[model samples]
Target chain A: MGTGFLDAFAQEYKQLLDSELRLLVERLDAPSIIKESMIYSLEAGGKRIRPLLLFATLDAFGIDPKNGLPAAAAIEMIHTYSLIHDDLPSMDNDDLRRGKPTNHKVFGDAVAILAGDALLTYSFEVISTLPNEFASADTKLKLVIEMARAAGTEGMVGGQVADMEGEGKKLSLEELDYIHIHKTGKLLKFCVVAGAIMAEASQSQLDHLSAFAHHLGLAFQIQDDILDLTGNQQVIGKPVGSDTANDKSTYPQLLSLEGARAALSNQINQAKEFLKKTGLNTNLLREITDLVASRDH
Target chain B: MGTGFLDAFAQEYKQLLDSELRLLVERLDAPSIIKESMIYSLEAGGKRIRPLLLFATLDAFGIDPKNGLPAAAAIEMIHTYSLIHDDLPSMDNDDLRRGKPTNHKVFGDAVAILAGDALLTYSFEVISTLPNEFASADTKLKLVIEMARAAGTEGMVGGQVADMEGEGKKLSLEELDYIHIHKTGKLLKFCVVAGAIMAEASQSQLDHLSAFAHHLGLAFQIQDDILDLTGNQQVIGKPVGSDTANDKSTYPQLLSLEGARAALSNQINQAKEFLKKTGLNTNLLREITDLVASRDH
Candidate 1:
């Protein structure tokens, strides 16, 4: 029912966020080399899913998607910084991300690390200074708190550490869920919560949206696990089955391949139900959920 | 006139901040390893100059020093995070800091990196959520803005990059000043600004305190450069003359050792002049200025 609208909204907002990311980095009164390093990664191609979810959520509330630009860019920066650090030789040691050389590979590790640090710090500054017309001071403060919690230890960082610790060992299904939920899932959930906060959604509406985000986040990660084995190398941009190659636990590892697919479908369906309960025009969000379920990368 | 007062004030608040640092890390619901890594560096024992400045600024304004605890901790977290990242093998490659192993040395590179990221992210969160008794929402938002600007690319990170780019080159006094002002100077300035913000000082008072802070920051760095050649290794907790050994440009390298000492004394006197203009009980601030001018480490 919403395929065309989702496509149009996604295309329009994706371009808007891309330019915003570039402009934001360029606007920093920093050394040119660091700015250039930051921009190189910011301009690296990704699906921009977090920003899409944020824009889609605002769309659901009938708010102007432009209102989400600062936040969308901030979240993307956080995500990109994580990826940069994750690809360091001490971490995952990957040379390529999305078919391009990693930040460390291009800038050398020192500048790359500083660039990542700069992006992470700059994000809070961006969110805290959102224009008065777009958000109240209280709203901005709350957003900062939420973003920090989601991206900090109790959420993404904690999850990443758990995932690292869990490597080279067989993990229970519960353990696998724990790692994905904190590591990848929290930031994705933040995209939704950030939208709801900006929209000033009621308590009940916020709860429904939060539940929808939780399910959607799980579905997104499970789909990623599925695609690791099934996605085309050309489409996914990295080697297929790299997760298996690393002996990492995945949904398809803990649950059989068929079982992982069933879990993904269940999560998607439940996410839709929560969206329905929000009693808002959630067509864009629903379509985004569908896309997450089926995306190759 | 303020000798005993300065000693007592510094002693009392440094202990308060030291405990607060430990408590803050313990309160985080993160993996023990990352928390330990973060705490390891946080406890690695610097003079707590930033927090002390903040507390002293509050004291000047007749504000309760306890009110500045959150902001003080937040600034310390940012400082500690920078050290952890800066000491990485790809960066300074320092194995020892303050006579103890660096975070990367103890925690491994990957965890040390993540721990730094976590501390940096958590700092904004800490400031944004300052309790109602400590700061208003508007004040918290402004603090976040100022902190980010001071710590992010426009400030510390920018300075670090410039410093890195200037390494092994013959830097002019202006170029060296540029690196120190942004890299180290900005964060120190933040401590004073943060204190003024919390104390709700008038614009004129804030301006005077900021000027004082600028001179103090420069004085602090110049003394650091001087001490690099002449400090006792036991008291400084690192080998003396390390900066000269690295061929990193220092005030002594550019201005000569005597010229660097002259610069330090000049900055301290200028800092005291600014403090006098503030028309507050700035004895603590004044004494701190003197300490910076003469400190061997």
Candidate 2:
């Protein structure tokens, strides 16, 4: 049952993301070099977790998931850009991501960097072009603000900086939480909340979704840590123990494996409780949360 | 008279930019390492050319420049982010910008890269937050599209790629034109067009501003090429002959000094003619055009 939910959700979201990315790239004008660079990494596969959460949140509000596609695409674009830059020779210096040669490795460092920059700027273009299917300008603007906050200084970028600065050093639980929340949690929150905002969900509903997403985000990171430590390279499709090789701190590094497992359980419970309050169909969300905690990779 | 215009314009724009940047940075949530990286470069002094162009265009339309502050700040944020990324060791590898260490040099490559990402994301946030003081949602959305096109694959980034690929190799004038227009011209065009769009200018007015800005952008870049060849480090605040050192093909390299001079003159004439059609307060815009051609650095 869990595998069924994961496979279905992943496939549907991937199809949606692929279509949206193609359409967005098609809208570019004649010059094709930069466009090709951008398309290269964007099409490079990753689990479309962020966009899935966004669409699911919208669906919970009885909103058509199509209404959330632009935001979905924009968040993925930002995510892909971050990955491309992070994998640069001067950064993580990784030559592979998801079992494929990294963007910089394939396109050269200059093209990879420019590709990241282009995608970051193009996300705003996606948000601004969102059709009037939105309930109000105020709501659309709110979604934009939420996304910017999530992606900007106080959010993912901040997290990445903290992670960089903290590498090869032991970090307290509080410090680690700070890094994860900003770096990964914020964008996840934006993914969920942006959908709710687009659908004009009640403030109360939004609050619940925020809580649910926050916990899920933490849970997601913890799982990533676990997979990094123990998963098979063939299944994970990225190098295992790469974090250890870099001397980066992770939940499993800070907390023992048992403690990390306990924390994961706690977070999963919090996500479930928050979702229950929404009184919406959360069967898929619940199953995904379980999958997040239980997946081997 | 022209010198006075240039000095006052530069001074006023600097002041406006300073205040806008302060407000923008102030909005960041408390104490994130990534925000620090962003602020490090954003506050470093550079010519506020893009924001100044935005404000000047707004001023020409009889709009209170304050109404356009969000757009002005947003454009600068985008420009600053591009500069930050461009200076990375993986890209242009410049250690200095505006007489200060580049962000990557001071903050480390990862932080610098993330900082650039933060600023790019924040630019859109600034735009979306424009209160009803600017215009309707449709108009604001239009501005977003214009800015995105200028910054994205088919615009500035595309130009940069062409530039990198064409480096050291001899290039036809058409290819060089392609690089300059897309890389620099597009964003410059956005500065003028976005301002006019916000001011609700007539279609004809927009067309005039567009043409004026197009020529002005090309002229500005050509002037940069000349400065790269002949200007002092103290005056330009960047190393002289850096382009030649990098084996970059510039206008001065592609066209002889005399040819470059004639091209600059022709562009200035075209820009002046376009501004003449607008019949607005042309003094500032006209002086700016002349300054582009005559600037020593």
In order, what DockQ does each candidate have?
Answer: 0.92, 0.64
lDDT of 2 by residue, B131-168 (tens): 87577776766777788889887888888888888887
TM-score of each: 0.98, 0.93
For each candidate, report what fraction of the true interface contacts it reproduces: 0.94, 0.78
lDDT per residue (tens digit) for residues B27-146 in model 1: 998778999998899888778899999999998989998889888999999999999999999999999887788999889999999999999998998898888888999999999999
Residue-level lDDT tens digits of model 2 in A1-297 = 446865776787789789889889878874576777788888886778888888778777777777788888999998998898889987888988877899888888888888888888888778766787654656666766787888877888878777877888999999899999998999989998888888777888889989999999999999899889889889987789988888989999889888888899899999999999988887767777787778776
Candidate 1 residues A202-244, lDDT tens each?
9999999999999999999999989999999898887899999
Cα shift from native, residue B277, model 2 (Å) = 1.5
**Top-DockQ structure, candidate number:** 1
Candidate 2 overall Cα lDDT vs. reference?
A: 0.83
Model 1: residues >4 Å from true position, as ranges? Answer: none
Predicted model with the maximum lDDT: 1
Q: List the candidate 2 regions with Cα displacement exceeding 4 Å.
A: A2-6, A134-137, A238-241, B3-6, B30-33, B230-234, B238-242
